[model samples]
Target chain A: MQSPTRAKKKTKATSMDIAHRAGVSQATVSRVLRGSPLVNAETRRRVEEAVKELNYKVDRHASSLRTQRSGTLALLLFEDPTPDDSHINPFFLSMLGSITRACARHGHDLLVSFQQLSDDWHADYEDSMKADGLILLGYGDYLAYESKLAHLVAQGTHFVRWGPVLQGQPGISIGCDNAEGGALAGRHLVAQGRKKVAFLGDASTHFPEFFARYCGCDAALREVGLRMNPALQVDADSTEQAGYEAAQVLIARGLPFDAIFAASDLIALGAMHALKEAGLRIPEDVAVVGFDGTPMARFSNPPLSTVVQDTSKAGELLVDTLLQLVRDQPAQSITMAPTLQVRASSGG
Target chain B: MQSPTRAKKKTKATSMDIAHRAGVSQATVSRVLRGSPLVNAETRRRVEEAVKELNYKVDRHASSLRTQRSGTLALLLFEDPTPDDSHINPFFLSMLGSITRACARHGHDLLVSFQQLSDDWHADYEDSMKADGLILLGYGDYLAYESKLAHLVAQGTHFVRWGPVLQGQPGISIGCDNAEGGALAGRHLVAQGRKKVAFLGDASTHFPEFFARYCGCDAALREVGLRMNPALQVDADSTEQAGYEAAQVLIARGLPFDAIFAASDLIALGAMHALKEAGLRIPEDVAVVGFDGTPMARFSNPPLSTVVQDTSKAGELLVDTLLQLVRDQPAQSITMAPTLQVRASSGG
Candidate 1:
């Protein structure tokens, strides 16, 4: 009843057939059958159904020898030049929280560290079997890290970063829509009858994320017959001190601006302090808006109105996407939508 | 030229003599020379001096062959029943920052995870060679953790906790002086003529840290011919919602309170909102004080006056103490002093 060739090639063809029927790669089916954490819930279900539908024989011994897994993920935080000893920027705290919870849910142990001092970490972490993959978080000059990312790709390291999702980037990235967030801030301020809006952040390709925000705000303003004055745009990193200094510079330029749109909440807070020191009443004299609705925004001096990113969702997707890559599955860059939260600072 | 018996026992006795001269155990000398991160600066200095003074021949081969070390520490956070999805209590954010920096200083990688999900972590972490030691952080019922800690000691797993430093505890602990912190808050409020001071926290033996704070505040009030009225105190955990509800409950009693000292900054923030809703003016109708000098306290509506724990120092000490235990060296419970930061809420 069975053909000789079909019987001889039964195991190999059945596995391939199972992969085809499950709409997954053979590697994913192997991962699912071996109980790999890298396989997502949906993929596992599809693989299992395909096995049953094909009447595939179970090979427990072979599945047990699939590969060694540490069931661990490492989070390498590229240090922020924080104003305080808390190595984390307050903005990353919420992201860290979501990542921690996500790791727990996926049953993967998370190893956290600053990427500053560790040398050859690209080889030391995953290649040494310390973790199954790496989750990178930080804000730095994109140009400086470009070569390092290329090296990581050359080494075939499984890593995912929380940054701007750009084409031809070395690794998969899960990011909040920074450009849309900037536009949202701009649209909100324009609706409040503010004509001139000054931006606080480095608007250069060296920092792609900030550059996108700058362009997005500029585009939004142009729609209302207004464009952001590059002369009014002061370069500032994501720190209250930097923000304060940038505002002082903007004020000294003698530029008449009706409103300020900071790229970050910390920058907005610093600018607010400078404006208040200059005796400007918020919303009455200078309407202000900030991005990144961090918890601190709720308690800011005037309660900052800002663009909010769903960090929890970003974190969950980051973990899932990294796992997918670890399991040799196809994964794509993800850009999440940002919502506007209007508070006292925006004259709301 | 050496006596036959002395020559025969030379290597062993000389090592012991080095240990005796260094005023450290033989194990510590070995650890120091092997470049163990477990040894502190002072201890390593002593051992190095002893080696030079004794003219001990450096055994390169044996030193290189010292026991396997992971150069890693695991941080297990005992979860707080937080009001939000940010798994961490904001108080720990500074601590985490300090700990991360501290780990970097010692050249050790840190693995951070919630202790709630993983069962048999005591065996899973150190026993399975995941880490050399563990640094535990959380604010939970001490009664429930007491037995588990005892088991950790039984299994000879090295660990240090961030909690109240008590005598005869299962393991070493590094903690802030809670009693002193509470007294500092009470003293500041009393200086403002706040007589009827209300306390917000579960001040019971189950929560020894809060209980100590409660007693300390009560003692400070007694110094001014006043004591904490049991009716004025409300039981609340370390959450803003709990603080808000506790404040509502306190206000519902219709008892007049001139001051409120919350156990945590989050609780204080919550209570302040409730007080404002009841049309009470802060630092006028009621002076408010909180514990944990978290950054959020800076942006509170009236800027909360808080008792500041030296989280940077605490984190450093926690790592140092855990390393001491990992090296099989004698370690003690450390209690760091707390300082008060008076803000607008305290009528400063």
Candidate 2:
């Protein structure tokens, strides 16, 4: 099975060489490589060994052309540039890592791209036939890109999105229970005997995930016969810089708030930075809580208290669901539960 | 140039339709799409307009069937499983981000995968012709994988590695000045009036990057009539858990070290955690510095001081160099400089 020296002698091995090495006919080698049921088990194994030893690729283009299945998945990440220059939100990077691993586990390849919000990426990916299906991951306005998703659905493209699993969405999705995550943060803060909580993130319909989180926090606050102050809430994107700026704006409003819940971990980190710069101590002054339990959250200055979205599970499900759609299996939208990680920042 | 509605009316558009829309013969459209110099700029623009508006892919597999180039790049990230299960080093994730962007800038698609160190990934990518070239990124024993690089070279596989730019390596590489990075950490600690500086990472040829960093730091210490104590160095991988365990070992050794320099940011982060757990105050009890100016360092407890490698430039160089090789252009192994980011962790 392992013949490194043989592979080196020939720059590119043809099917004839594979057939010769396997002690089989070229037709048998083709049958084995093409996953035909006509080939016997022992003969298929032998042909595969020969293919490996000879470093033969079986002309992926020709194979894909015949089957119309490229055995590849395209991951189109809508670029959300941050001040840190990572170009991808750290939370999304973790997702990307998991998704890549899951693809390997499922025996598929992944084609990754950082796309602008305005690109006609959905149609292009399907039309190009570069992949069997698509996995959409990013941070941006849901409304802004919803039309593109509708277009994808209209054209019958197989795609799964990573965001809030909303009703009437054009495509299938795998998402965290943002409301449950926010409620957990709020209830934790509420149990700490805190009131007048401020939220940092856009709570508009454009960003439904953040909006759901806002509503969930409000519901938790309502449990204590209280409601989130509209004036205390400042709209911010899912970025540290935006979180910092939103915090500054909240501070400038001269409103008294005891606890702050950021829509995402990055926003929480930035808000914490601003709070510290303004001489506000963590937990004692403002009990700060963030979303997304990324590794970065665990190592923050006060070990940020965050709503840990199950990214590992999310990645697996995203791949699984997309593959289901690709194989014409009945795949449905999935929503995973979120949990709270109490740490120093939230008075743990 | 853009016509979304018409594209939706038809599920798939053909070359004949593009020719008709461009007001040219199918031959002219084919020449223009194939990028033959025989087609003029105005005709090319008109045909391209038709292609985009109609959302015709031109069948990537069929096109590559005629021409050898796949117009795709494969990024094989050797999985370095961290305790957090992200499966990729955060530093490498940054490089991945930049590399993905660079591929987009260069008009090439990117195929990403998490490969095991022992897998025949190098040969598979080349043999499959799934990508025009390969970009290999990961962290492990250099000697363990050096033979694999040699195998790739022997097979005339087009590849660029991300690691130490050794003078006589089998394939081309784009790397950071690791020794200089180590020197930066040593000099900074020295400037803080620290005499005893410990190092965390493997200091052997097996891990050339870490070994070079160890050597660089030792060299810097020697300039001030001092040398790194052999007892103070601990062997560890580039993971937070590894760092933590290494630091615990160092603490148990009772080596009177006043400072510590980790080989990577993950190690520093883990070491910092262990140090804090053992009732040691950062910068005061033991000044600590790390390499890899990842964003995680910027938000860590006491804001970890770290050596910064120019990953964006490295990404650009890796892609540019690989494309050069793919195009039969001259490519060379390039080394980039490193800088230090001073933070409170190192008493900055």
Give me the candidate number with maximum TM-score: 2
Candidate 1 runs further than 4 Å off = A1-68, A80-83, A117-120, B1-68, B80-83, B117-122
Docking class of 1: incorrect
Q: How well is each residue in A1-348 modelled by candidate 2, as lDDT tens digits?
A: 111221233446778899999899998999887789999999999999988777688777877766777899999988644335454688888899999889999999899998888786877876777888899998787888899888887887889999888877777888999998888988999999888899999999998999999999999999989889999999999888899999999999998999899999999999999999999999899999999987789889798999998778899999999998887777788889999999999898
Per-residue CA lDDT of candidate 1, range B120-187, in tens? 56545664355778888888888877888877776666788899887667877889889999899888
True contacts kept of each: 0.30, 0.54
Residue A249 in candidate 1, Cα distance off native in Å:
1.8
Q: Give the clashing pairs for model 1.
A: none
Worst lDDT window (10 residues) for model 2 chain A?
A1-10
Please give the lDDT score at residue A79 for candidate 1: 61
TM-score of chain A of 2: 0.93
Q: Write the per-residue lDDT of candidate 1 for residues A1-348, one digit (tens) a residue.
A: 110111111222246778999999988887786688999899899989988666554331132123435677888888634346753577788788789889989988788877752344554576445577899888888887777777677667788889988867787788988889888988888999999999999999888988889888888999989999999999999988889999999999998998999989889988998999999889888988888888888877788998988888888999998898777777778889999999999898
> lDDT per prediction?
0.80, 0.87
Reference-based TM-score, model 2? 0.94
